[model samples]
Target: MRKLWPVILVLLIAVGLAVVLFPNGHKSLRAEKGPKPAQQSQSRAVAVEVAPAVTAVYQEDLRSVGSLMSDESVQIASEISGRIESFRFSEGQTVSAGDELVKLDDALARAELVDAQARFELARANLERARTLSKSGHVTERAQDEAKAAFETARAAVELANVRLAKHVIKAPFDGIVGLRNASVGAYVSIGTPIVNLEKIDVLKIDFKLPEAALTQIFPGQSVTVEVDAIPGRTFEAEIYAINPMVDVNGRALHVRARMANPDLILRPGLFARVTVKGRETRNVVMVPESAIVPRAGESVVYTIQGGKAVETKVTLGRRSAGMVQILSGLEPNTTVVVAGQLKLSNGSEVEIVQTQSPSALEKS
Candidate 1:
């Protein structure tokens, strides 16, 4: 039994050694007779066309909110107190300057004019007869003088009547579109009561209030661009017509006006608009690709190619458009910036420029 026990122990030890060393032996055997090579991992670098960084001249653009308004907006009111006899122009109708719009009962005016004309004619005849008598010494000089004064008075009355008769016909002050009529035919109207609203829309005035700091760039006759949210993809061009000389003390803003031609009359008054003022065109500024500007925290950063390695650089940026941004400071012209393949980069990280392109790499040439 003792001899069998030693043999059993020996067998158990051999089994344990085989189990512990089997995997390692198998690995060594495979190494001696190498297995097939593993496939390479796919690269993340995205292939993109690139160009050297260059300076770009940009026109400084000022953005602000504005509204479309009529060049001349006014509420037409009745000048004389009387009932509206008839309307020559209807609501939403276009009228020309001096075109009759409303007619008031001018029967009295007409009668007054007729009576004044007859009086003038009678006075003229009397004066003629008196002059002839005076010339022949048939009438006294005082009588001739009185006849002359009567003729002048009669003529003055006729002129005054004609002036009042003209007021009975209300004419458009300027070429414009008529709004809703407040008074209808046979409706009594008092002096200074609104009859209709008239607005000249051939040229629209865009009014906007902007920060007073922008006043430096605002001037009369400067070119401006306007956009309305309601009309997307459409932009209107205008010229700055005027800028208020004073700024509002409460809002700290200045009023600016731009004139836009509305030949088709597409723009209407009271429509909201977004305005862009083209200030002085800035020249000789460095431009970098938008991708190169990396936003970190509240600031933006970029990687510059320095000493053949990636270097962290903080940049001051301005006006981003067309996939590019203007460098206000912190970067010089001719500086090489890594636009693509900058995600995996760190300061002084070793990078191999794979012309084949690997998106995972942080350095881009």
Candidate 2:
């Protein structure tokens, strides 16, 4: 036991010496830890593509879908019910106002009118004779008064008969082009029944809607470019004449109407049209590539290089055309904006601008 105690004491001294010399275990066996993840990321730079903001002539225009309408449209119908006796205007014919379009059976109306005229003539003669007799004291004053009243009633009847006879023939209310016939000759038609369509298409109207946000960008008498798929590769110019004051709550849009000349008759109503409402042109508008914009939290943002770091910047956007967008605000001219590799960027992040475009190249004509 004594011999073992000496051996144990010597072992304790060696262990104490080792502890004093090396506090952390053997260096060869120890695991070496590298730099912290956050520290490493902070020291590393994110590679990104950038472009300098530039100025150019820019126009912000609104595009909307609409339908073309005739300047004046109505259905040719009879004012009185009768059988169609004849049609004075041919289908697809252009007629002037007051040109008779259709005729109906007016025999009964004419007979009644003739009867009314005869009665009116007789009453008038009796009235004259009654007054003459009253002056000579041959007829009583009451008899003369009755004859005068009868004469007035007969005259009214004649005028009413003439009006009825005139309604048997339907006339064009305005100068217009007539559509296909809805009723044939000898077909019975009632009042207000659609006989055919009449449209004043010498001038055409276009009806469309625009977002309520664009209310300030439009006005009456402004010109709009319209294109129809039916007539491809051609643009029809129109002038705005009306804008509805009320905004649609459900769609947040405004109704607008424009007029255009169709003297050539190249375009027709009911065609789907695309309307371009051009905004006022402005030179030297700040422009940037559309790819540089990043949408976040329902707002637009751009990553600009500031002090060799990516600074998340909020910006107001204007009209976008081609591959570019207008920077209405939030960025200075000639500022470098990240166009690519923005997905790896954050505010205050160190960035390496691998490729930067010159202002002239970015704003090239």
Candidate 3:
């Protein structure tokens, strides 16, 4: 019985060793009892939403600072040297053309005219007597000729005196508003002495400087829109009257002048204004938000969505304003562009556009 018990103990140890070494065979012997792994659910891809492109007409405008001036301005000066006897018009008063504005002393000039007239009468009488005597051989031919020459000289002197007297009254050259009077009544003024400043303000001339690149577009008779800081909410329409032929050597800019009507004279000379030169309207140009413009390798580019991925596109640009940039080439008007998430975008990265209320929300999707 003792030998039988030892054999049975060895047989049990061998069975335990076999079960530990081979578990699959042991599980089959143990009625197929085993722990099973839990099955994992299938994963889903993330949903990325993208906005479709929008089509809109982009308007471009140019802004520049300019100055307004009078259409006609003249610094009036004395024509003849004399004492100013009277001033016919007050300073700052509007005067018509040919209106007498100043009067110089003309008593001496008139007296000279009278003396020349008397000398002309005496010479004419002598020439007539000499001609009559020469016909009768009582006067020599040389004497008759001398008398005729004296009469002609006297007539010329009278005309010269009349012209000198006419210069005493200085008249307004044009209809304009006069500035400050430099010469007062009873003051002596010389020829070419500045009397007052005159300006025609029924219309004003606005002048501005533009870069040489605008030379081709700036021509005579082009329309311009003008805005003055002094009078807000008012816009004046003008036409390009002139353009400088020579470009400024120092600044490389061309000067332009435009005429603006100012019937109320509200637009004063020397007032600063904002000027816009209206070019021909361009149509069907591709545009995107100015913020989407990116500088790469000395060129401008923007990321546009294509085939569900962002693609970098190089574009030629033109006039830009109002938070919009005009794409001159390499882009279509309906091409979708990355507007907001450009910082995290790559060439082929997926983009999800966040839907939010925008100014153009009412537009078609």
lDDT of each: 0.82, 0.92, 0.80
Residue 323, model 2, lDDT: 82
Pitting candidate 1 against candidate 3, the one with the higher lDDT is 1
In Å, residue 287's CA in model 3 sits off its true spot by 0.3
Task: Name the lDDT value of residue 128 in candidate 2.
Answer: 96
Backbone clash pairs for candidate 2 read none
Best by TM-score: 3
Instruction: For candidate 2, give the lDDT.
Output: 0.92
Task: Please state the error at residue 206 of candidate 2 in Å.
Answer: 1.3
Cα misplacement distance, residue 5 of candidate 1 (Å): 8.8
* Candidate 3 local lDDT, 142-215, one digit each (tens): 99999999999999999999999999998998999999999788999999999899999999999898888888
Ranking by TM-score: 3, 2, 1
Model 2 worst lDDT window (10 residues) = 26-35
TM-score of every prediction relative to native:
0.72, 0.77, 0.78
How would you encode candidate 1's per-residue C-alpha lDDT over 1-365 as one tens digit per residue? 98799999999999899988785887788887874444221232222222345666677778889789899988988788888999998799999999999999999999999999999999999999999999899999999999999999999999999999999988999999999988778999988999899999999998898888887888898888899888899999999988888899999999988899999998898898998888777787777778788788899888776555777888888887666788888888777677777777777744445442222232232
* Weakest 10 consecutive residues of candidate 1 by summed lDDT: 356-365
